[model samples]
Target: MSTAPETATHFRPVPVGLLRGRRPAVPGPAVPAGTGVEVRHPTRLNAMALDPSKIVGTAAADDGEPRGSGHPAGELFVVCDLFRTARVEIVPGSDEVTTTGHCSRPVLARHAASVMRELLGITDGLLVHTEGVDLPPHVGLGSSSATMASVAVAINELYGRPVEARRLIRFLVDNHGEEIDGRSDSLMPVQCIGGSAAAGLIPGSVQVVAGNAVPLLSAGLPADYRIVLAMPADPTEWDAQQSLQEEARHFDDFLRTGRRHAPDIAYRLIHQAWPALLEGEVREFGKLVFDYRFRMGSIKNCSFSHPRLLEFADAIEPAFTNGAADVLGLSSVGPLFFAVTRTEQKVTELFRDAGLRTFAARPWSEGYSVVKSW
Candidate 1:
């Protein structure tokens, strides 16, 4: 049995400048307002899952501030960057709600419309266009949440900014899940919601403390760190013909295990991982990250066990030996693997040598900055 440390009661914010890597410059001409608004949200890797009951919850969705749930809960995630982006464009005053994009998913567009209708209580004529780095549809990496977050930010911008940053995160958690469909698709999409959702929607590295109110803080890591994603070129798909009952059973079992194991999971995430990340202890941080992934993998139906992933891990083993990269682990519900490294060059070379598609991303510091406003 492992000893647990004191639970985190409050969030400690990190200085943005101290975080490693430059946020990639967003592209495209500035929005002139009347035409439309374009927004970019980053993809995330779940480092750990915090017990839900520990997260401070809002009395109601609209109240906005987080308060304790006063009961034990399960199903919250601690996330980091993969750096792939989901970009959305909203052109309001259309004839009806229309969504068009190269990489947009039907469920995502559906949720975006639903959120708009629920938030505004009306959706007569709104149009949303989304497209982004072609993220593998269902191998985790918080694609669903990222899509929803991109659309949410764009919609929030269209509506004259009624939802504040913190409140916006609550919106993404409203639903989350997935197997071949995605990670968050298994739950309410809440499990996939993390610092990436907050960062992309609001624009900063948000550390969500799952307690009474689910407190979120803007935290940063040292500038010397780097995140590299080893994404598989092709993703396998689940048969749509598979019985719904089987799927239900799979999810049910997964949830039950998470609940039963919540305490241990929560302790590692809040007590161990949090401090390592905060203080910039790279190897220790990586070890805790490995521990988190290992623990999650042990859960039935939750394992990301794949031969290709292991092969990739083996291929990148030398980086650890030479101290180019400090740690490596699976990215949330992934076929996408990640490595925490000392430099960007090491990450690039390793992936290039393996011939796997790679993406480089830094922790976002600004929660949500309007790139262009009319």
Candidate 2:
């Protein structure tokens, strides 16, 4: 496979407005006989919505209703890490969609089918094997959306499409609207494709995704910034589709009451931390990091729900004491906490002191890449 096209052009800022209608479909570019392509999508740490108030009704809706009330407006920051990622391999000419890889699951297969039907309009056979990292469901690392984004990029490459990572993210958000509710589809392009961006709606639309990459005030993180992920040893992965769907429904109910929590989200992210990131003021940004952990979790009704998670969050305070970490927060919901440190090695030792599973990572700068094609 040839290298992935530079995504800067793909991620360029689109005009702020509701894009009308689905894009027209065209036949995928032909590939040489027996060609196989592999593509990679990174994982994310947190997705901080700037104006939490506008999160629900911002992106253009796919159902043909006016995208939203035409008033909601804000951005979201997709904090990404390359420590764990989804790598998907695509082999064409199969009779049906066949998948293999630790990240490969039934839902993933279904999503691939849906992508094929909706994006390529092809019912042809394709074998897709996902590799790298076991993405436990709802881990808050944007794994599900990253998986979809990875496969989407792979398929795009197969068709020789030069779609932007951001556009693919929006495309997935628009097409798989309902499937991504309560999930972080907006952040997928940020993680799998690289760069931390502030994505939001222009008005009259709702992004309606947990991981879809949205428009950003800025992309990428400051140089020399470091991150450490403290995940539970037993993720106790949820395998039940019904239970997950129930969670999604409850999440929708929670969003209906966004007024209750959106303000805090806005203050911490948009008013405070967003500037801290831009100005390279880690300490000021660190304070918002502490506040957001509690506030964002409360909105999810799971703040401080896990003893190990709390214990880790508490024990790592010594990091601030020792001049190692400048900021600390939980990633998404529960059981995955992160620290912004001067050095990854120092944070790793601190996690050791707390007896937690940990990995050293940094903010990813690049998005998806094609490693091989044969």
Expressed as tens digits, the lDDT of each residue in 1-374 for candidate 1 is 11111122221221111111111122222222344566666555655445422222222222343321122232322234443333334445653555654546645654565544455544445565556566555565666666667776776675566666655555455433222334322222122234445556533343543532234543565666667777667655542212122233344444544566677765765677667767766566566555544444422233333436656655765666567777666655566667767687877788769767887776555544445544
Q: Distance (Å) between predicted and true CA of 260, model 2?
A: 4.6
lDDT (C-alpha) at residue 272 in model 2: 69
Q: Give the alpha-carbon lDDT of every model.
A: 0.49, 0.49
Instruction: Please name the candidate that would achieve the greatest TM-score relative to the true structure.
Output: 2
Q: What's model 1's lDDT at 330?
A: 65
Best by lDDT: 1
How accurate locally is residue 280 in candidate 2, as Cα lDDT from 0 to 100? 67
Scored against the true structure, residue 346 in model 2 reaches a CA lDDT of: 82
Over all chains combined, what TM-score does candidate 1 have?
0.67
